[model samples]
Target: MFHKEGHKIIIITFLLVVAVALGAEYLIPIPWLQVCIQIPALILLILILQFFRNPKRHTPHNDDHIIAPVDGKVVVIEEVYEKEYFKDKRIQVSIFMSPVNVHVTRYPLGGEVVYSKYHPGKYLVAWHPKSSEDNERTTVVVKNKVWGEVLYKQIAGAMARRIVNYAKPGAQATQGADSGFIKFGSRVDLLLPLNTKIKVNLHQQVKGGIDVIAEK
Candidate 1:
């Protein structure tokens, strides 16, 4: 299935591809030239379609388990001081998303959104050490009786131009539900309690709403 955020772009891309194919079919004198033009046009449309594809995920709901919020590889797992909200030492787990990875952000666990804020900043590479703080991002904290507050940040990568966030303070968040989308590529940082047990390792590939990244 396609994501709602991609509907407009998908339609525009489909029309553009059709126009390009038609122009090549009739205007190009050589078959090889037409093939070259049409093939790339189709490929462009395919890439856009694939980028926004939102496959349904059946999230195994467990309040104690914190699942991966996006489809990507685990790039960072370390204890760091999160200054924006908690302002204390926490285990920060960061997942880096490439151009081809699913860009939909999901709630790691069900809870009430205690804090949600957007920051407009530089578009550094997602993996850069300072990207989480220097790049365009959004910080959201979900609080529940079982897990307390779990904070996650969506950091925009160099290729990303927009970060869509659906989280609002005081709103209810469902575990594994779509929380937002980051166009092109980015990364997500999950800041948990210092004693939280991380289940994933560096370079490990994970799926949004599917893979557990940590637990109490």
Candidate 2:
């Protein structure tokens, strides 16, 4: 199914595609050229629809497991100094989402949102080492009895200009539930305790709200 956040854009795109096809059919005298132009427009609409699709996922209700926040390939898994919320060393797990991947972001686990902040910055490539710190991003920290405080960030890539975040301080975050959405391409960084057991490795493909990325 398509995501609710994309309903307006999808409808607009659909109407634009239909208008273009009709214009080509009536305005273009050459039938072959009209077909060629309409075909590309139709393909573009299909691609956009596919990008915003929010497939239903049944997340296992395990408090110890941390579900992936977005559908993408794991790019980084290492210990890094989490300078934002924790201000200490933590294990960092990063997933890189391309234009074709679903742009929806989900909460990794259920908890009380302790911190939520947005930082506007440069639009660097999502995979770049500095992208997590330099790119436009939103930082969200969720605290639970099982996992303490887990920090996750949505970093905008070169293609993404808007980052929508639903997290706010003192709000309850449900595990594997929709937390936000990023337009086009982006990356998500999860900062967990250094001793947390990682379930996935670098380069592994993950599905948001489906794949378990780590465990306490």
Candidate 3:
């Protein structure tokens, strides 16, 4: 199986260290320097193990009306002024992702992409209030028959910079289908209709491509 590049980072680091260890004997042939190299090599190996650890999966069994766009803890869930696209009051649910969380984004509902935009901004912390507005983000609006129109955004955080969005203005998107990917840490915001029922709460952990966030 092909591992995601994020998963392979640790493996590549380990191999590089091993190669350096073997090359030291031929190049330097110094006993004192070998001990120095060995100590740091052990430390790096431990860090690689931690970086490669898989987060617990939390996929929901059903997808009736809504699903999670990304995996992480819900940081904000309340009625707020959504100034980005609608410029009106809407229910905003924000999920904060740590470095360990899967950064891939999925469509929350099956529909045709109505609009899509990518913004360039600052790398604020994912949980910060300004992060959603100030951080680099990609906005996708999907038109669903049952849900009407829904908008979801992928925002980059301090450790994350690249936001990969695949859906175009007229693309077809299925519920739980891959829409894009964010590197490292980030956040996602789901802007829902005022009457849509929110199923998750603050600090509640949710899984991308699963974990329904709302329903008709």
Candidate 4:
């Protein structure tokens, strides 16, 4: 099914496509030129439909496991100093989502949302080495019973303009449930405790809520 975050854009796109197609067919004298105009309009709508498509996922609940928060390629896995909240070393697992991938952001694990904050910054490419820190993004920390605090940051890429975050302090977060959405292409970085085991390798394709990223 489609995601709730895309409802407005989808409807507007549908209307625009209809108008453009009809306008081109009746107004343009050249058949080939009309076809070109309508085709791109149709393709734009199709891309929008696919970008926000959110499929149902049955995530096995486990306090020890951290599921992938978004469908993407595991682009990074390394121990880095988390300057914002942790202020110490943690294993950072970054997943890069393309415009073709599902843009819905899911909770990595069920827990109490202890910290959630937004930061405004430059729109760098999702895979940029400094994008995680310099991009427009939101940082959310979910405190699991056994896992302590699990931090996930949604970083907006050059194509992304808005990063919608539903996380708030004191709210309950369900594992694999919708946490937010990132418009267009983006990346998500999960900072786990030092002892957490990395389950996914770099460049591995992962389905959100279905693929595990790490474990206790």
The TM-score values for the models, in the order shown, are 0.98, 0.98, 0.80, 0.98
Model 3 regions more than 4 Å off: 1-18, 21-64
In model 2, what lDDT does residue 74 have? 100
| Candidate 2 TM-score, C-alpha based | 0.98
lDDT of 4 at 193: 94
For model 1, how does the per-residue alpha-carbon lDDT over 54-89 read when each residue is reduced to its tens digit? 999999899999999999999999999889998899
lDDT of 4 by residue, 137-187 (tens): 999999977999989999999999999999999999999999999999999
Q: After superposition, how far is residue 33 of candidate 2 from its true place, in Å?
A: 0.7
The local distance difference test score of model 2 is 0.95
The local distance difference test score of each candidate is 0.95, 0.95, 0.80, 0.96
Cα displacement (Å) at residue 75, model 4: 0.6
After superposition, the stretches of candidate 4 with alpha carbons farther than 4 Å from their true spots are none
Query: Residue 57 deviation, candidate 4, in Å?
Result: 0.9
lDDT of 3 by residue, 111-190 (tens): 89999999999998888998888889999898877877888899999988688898899999877777887877899999
Q: lDDT of candidate 1?
A: 0.95
